[model samples]
Target: MKLILKACIILIILSNTAIAQRLYNTSEKLWKPQKDEAFLQEIATTIPTNEPVVSVAETNETCFALMSGNIYALKSGKLNKDNSAPAGVTELKNKNGDIWALTDNGIFRFQNDRWKKIDDKKYVDLCMHAGKLHAATSEEIYRLEGDRFVTTKPENGYYSSNMTMLMEDGTQLHDDPVRLGPISKIESYSGTLYVLRPGKLVLFDGLIVNEDFIDWGLLPSKNTRDMLSFGRRLFISTDRGMGVLQGAALKTIKGEEGLPVENTTCLERGFDQDIWIGTERGAVRMLKDEWHYFGADMWLPDNKVNDIAVGNNVVYIATEGGLGVINFEPFTLQKKADFFERHLEEWGHKRLGFIHTVYQKDGEWVREISDNDGGHTAPYLAAMCYKYAVTGDPEARKEAVESFNAMLFLEKVSPIDGFFARSIWSTTGDKDEMGRHGSGGLPAKWYKTADGKWYWKGDTSSDEVTAHFYSVSLFHDLVAKGKEKEMAKQHLEKIAAYIIDCGYTLHDMDGKPTRWGRWDPEYLLRPYGYVDRGVNGLEALTFMQTAYNLTNNKKFDDSYNQLIKWGYAANTIRQKNVFPPENLAPWDDNLAFESYYTLLRYEENPALRSTYLRSLERTWEVKRMEHISWFNFAYGAITGNDCDLEQSIKHLREWHLEPIEYNFRNSHRDDLFVEPGYTSYEGGLKAISPREKNITRGSRNAVALDGGQNGRRIMEPTGFIRDYWMARYHGFLEAPETNDPELTSVKRRTEQQFGAEPYKGLEKPVFY
Candidate 1:
């Protein structure tokens, strides 16, 4: 029934197709302080195994621990191996309540409480499928036909022991017995059979041996010990850490993601659907909620784990020390209070309680509060606004108050009316290195204030404006009460009133609008200001709405309506009409999210809501990869359109866990289609071609980290504290799933904040 051929096709060596591995200097100093305490503190104890454990298996009644070359049965918390127990056992199995062992000497079956020798010949593995016994050796697969083991033949073509890796150009590399080692592992999934050889995966559908294959070298260590599938992803364990394969992409998770080392030994899927890994150093369990690590001296004895098996609530680990068992639960707290408190106090605080970006100088982490201080700090302030507005957590309220007061210092210290400085620094006579980004200072966009003792950045962009207004609006409506609330209202009025009084343009002391701070009729109506008009006009409208919302000022409404009547609303919509492959740039999306937040505040107006919702949807679709949690949660709160709750959480996790700036390259992959030309100004724009690049990204993206700092590293990541609480506030991602009592569902996770929405009677803490 099987067809045999002497030789066949050419080997195709595909280039540029490689798996992703990222490196981060976490122990060193960087832009932010990501202690990963939540990721760290969850570690359970590591048990010591006195013997060298090489393999492990769990049967219904007993657990088998293979150490050195002896098969030991773990019972009553004690390990006992028979003196005649098969030595050099490669793997142990409890098949359907039947104890079986695969050793180099022979295949043995245990029955009636004792080992019964079944076959004297050697075998690699033993498995039963469709009520038939099957065994695999290095070069051949055997099936039981009645009493005799027979070689199972392929239906259409003979699976020859000899195989060739054919190149695309008709060249075949013939190394039959050299590099093409025996089948190490095999598994059947759906209707396809996957066989793992020494350096390649041969997949068959029982009929044809497909030409498609994966490069084994693509693995982090390529010393792949074993593999299994959970959900839609394949879990691969190698000499290095762990890996997950979904579709065409392979993501290698290493030490940066809480992994202690890269030398991984074994892997198994937990009863609770978690991924359990065994390594030379310690054992790791990737729970749905968090990554759990077990260190040798920390709790583990011997430190080297050879095999892992999970039963119900306990993890049975086979280690060189003997055996280690761990009991772990998922970290399921909805609020990350510790992360917020620690990080905000450590890296976010600037001079006089203001917010500033933090980075490392030498070995110490320092908050660079004076560099684009307004832009970096605003995201944090907004996050706190959502926190206080929703939960009324006193800590959030206190931080918000501190941030608000610091922002006020920006205006008070400036001699120019209503002009807020980018940041403040101790008045040194030399040029403040705050604005000196890469090459030089921010191109004359800075000036010393009236006092020689202070300096503030000039030519401020609209990014700072929206951040200040947005945070102030949230504080006014949510946290600040009475006089403090009135202060926020006063601040909003002065900023809005200044813009309106100056013909809808933010004018500097030079009596000229900043380069990107113009929305007056002269700029919006002029042809030269086309690019600025669409975005600026949109921003100014939102700014007015925030002012009106906070102060209930009629003039803010009048100013907002005047722009609508002037056709800037329609113009704004047209200007932001990005579709398909053409997406919103990063800065533009930032502006759009800020615009969405402020515009959606006065949702009582149906017509205005309709106008902005369309633009928001387009922006959300295009910028989905950005995974702005606050933006995503805000949208989910207002519209309930899933901006990908799970991936949104993954994005936040990546920020919290690995905040390094690893370079991502799109030039190589064959699976992704490339969009040619002119989308972005710098570097290159590579979109997911065949289909437009939307938001189907996981923690790993199309971008691959090539070991170095690819671009600017960020200190203040935007999501986490704000968006997470917002999702909870909006009643989107609340209540744990009954099936999985732990871990937030990334895919279905959902959110809110700002304004007094009658509080919904949610619990609140005293802010005093």
Candidate 2:
């Protein structure tokens, strides 16, 4: 069952920028430190691209940089391979002349300048013969016999490897059969011998064996660190840079050409023909093709280089803070958007107005603005009340009047009547952190009032009265005007007249029933709030028909005609066709998409618009795989239906969403399939987080990706700014042309006053 076909991507990845270049003007300083490049120091812990250098015969008397068994040297009034060697004096490499070393206890030369053992037994490689010196050791092969190298063997296993040849003589043997170990170099050139192999370096010439002149692109087959050729061009180097192959073209020089350090271990050519290189973070000369770099802010004592021998006049570096030398200079620049606006003020903590979620802990990142602030800051206060009703911006109406006065101080710090607090810390905090932040295990509450001065978080559930009457009816229909719409219609009329004066529920201060904040009519006629009897009687008849359309009152219209004459709106269309999101759970699909937007705010009557169009055609046939742009704009704004507006603008162009509180986890996806249990009207409540990084954009049966709930943080998606300003204040959408804060909030405006052309096919085109 491998389906995954999803197509429709589209992403200009944001760069239209012009609503007066908005990053919210001025006071800009969001952290940006990458402070300029260039410099070196830090000699060891690594640098062994199988020896980026180890010399004696290419003489300057004593040059070394092998690392991983450390050894670095070079100094003579620091002579002139472009001078600079600070942590020098590690020792042994002809400290002042005569150097020759191989050791396992054998071949050690260097006369009048010290070192002497000359060759007695052990050896793994240091051979030249036909011209005097010899030694092999994989199990014997020596031929110096006078100053003594002794024993030998080449009889059956025709030996001699540096990349495989066993040709009886031509000399060489430290094998490589695809790097089965030992074989970092063998060179010879002209008459051809070159073996180097780990990422392709073969050659042979004695009757053809070329290796098609080696290619290996962004260099990396086995750290082919140093290869150089000169003139006919070969270069190679690589810890990811300097490949240059020439002729059939194979270019690569990296660190974006300025070569400050991408790892390159060693490469030498310099004497004015310039090439030098060798780095961890220091020394890169290139010349004529220009690239200087040098690091550790110039004058190395570290910066992990490991080998760079130049000779004719000093140049040695092998660092992990040990032997680095430098005649350096490079460092000056900074502004990767000021390092991404100081990496977004490195994660919040706005204390006293509650922000929390800047998480990291014990090693720091912290934000915990006291966790679960009302089932997640009511979709970030309805995304700052649809960003203060489509940018009438006075800083989005002072962040929607400070998240609507901290959600009207959660029903006025509830001293018992309207109950609401799911967050507020500091009675010196943790006063039982909402008893371990319940998802469905739903317990742990704290009260502590008077003289305690602060600390009030009772279990007023029903997802904070469905995000406080849907973000106070989006701040009383788009950013409150007249005395903030009579102070948000007098706090939604004292939180729905204290839940219709306690008869509907929410009664903490131990007046009982705060658990699951029950709905009225004696808890929906019988089974006492039976799994919250269908979205608690459709969120108490849409909060008393939105407090009887803002106090035309008649006892909030006779408590919405006494919950539609006691049948409680036909038990919310028969407990919404038996809550089938394959049997109910993720907060009963967030109380059936927050009781299907108050049955479309009373779908213009006509018998409650045919039972709210038969409960949104059975909740949009099981919530269209949750590309839930607020249930495709409230079922195309209450039943002109035909949803899937290109999978809700492909979830409003996904765009890496991370505005903080991460932890999304798609149950480690593999496409799909995994039914699992549920249905007892969903009371079992187990599924802790899977449905697309944890649903709750007012959850329409959290479509697939397995029932949710598991440390489900998911902070700011602001449900793509609450389904693009409620699909552009319900015209169903298409008005964007580009003012650019994310393409002027996804510009797209045509549909005329509302749902015209019955939303035919929804335009399409978008592939990323």
Over 4 Å off in model 2, which ranges?
Answer: 1-184, 187-235, 238-241, 246-250, 257-263, 266-423, 431-768
lDDT of 1: 0.57
lDDT of each: 0.57, 0.50
Best by TM-score: 1
- What is residue 519's positional error in candidate 1, in angstroms? 0.9
Residue 90 of model 1, lDDT score? 74
Error of 1 at 126 (Å): 9.4
lDDT of 2: 0.50
Q: Which ten residues in a row have the lowest lDDT in candidate 1?
A: 15-24
Per-residue lDDT tens digits for candidate 1, residues 427-485, read 53222255554112435555675655666676666777877776777667556767788
Per-residue accuracy of model 2 over 1-768 as CA lDDT, tens digit each:
133322211111111112212311223322221112221211111122333233322255455443333333434523122122212212223212334455555556656544457655545444343444434453334556566666433333333233455346765444532221243443344434444555656554333345556544434435776676666566667666667665545577664554545567766666557777766656666777545444332234454565565545345555555454433211111111112112222333233444344444444344443435655566656655654454354665676676677766766666654566776645543312344554356656776656565665676677777777777776776667777788777777777888778887777776787667778666667774565666678878888887777767788888888888887777676555443444455555555665566546533577876785676666555554444567666665555445666546434442222333223322322222212322223322222221123323454333332332222232334445555555544444534433333312222343332111121111211211
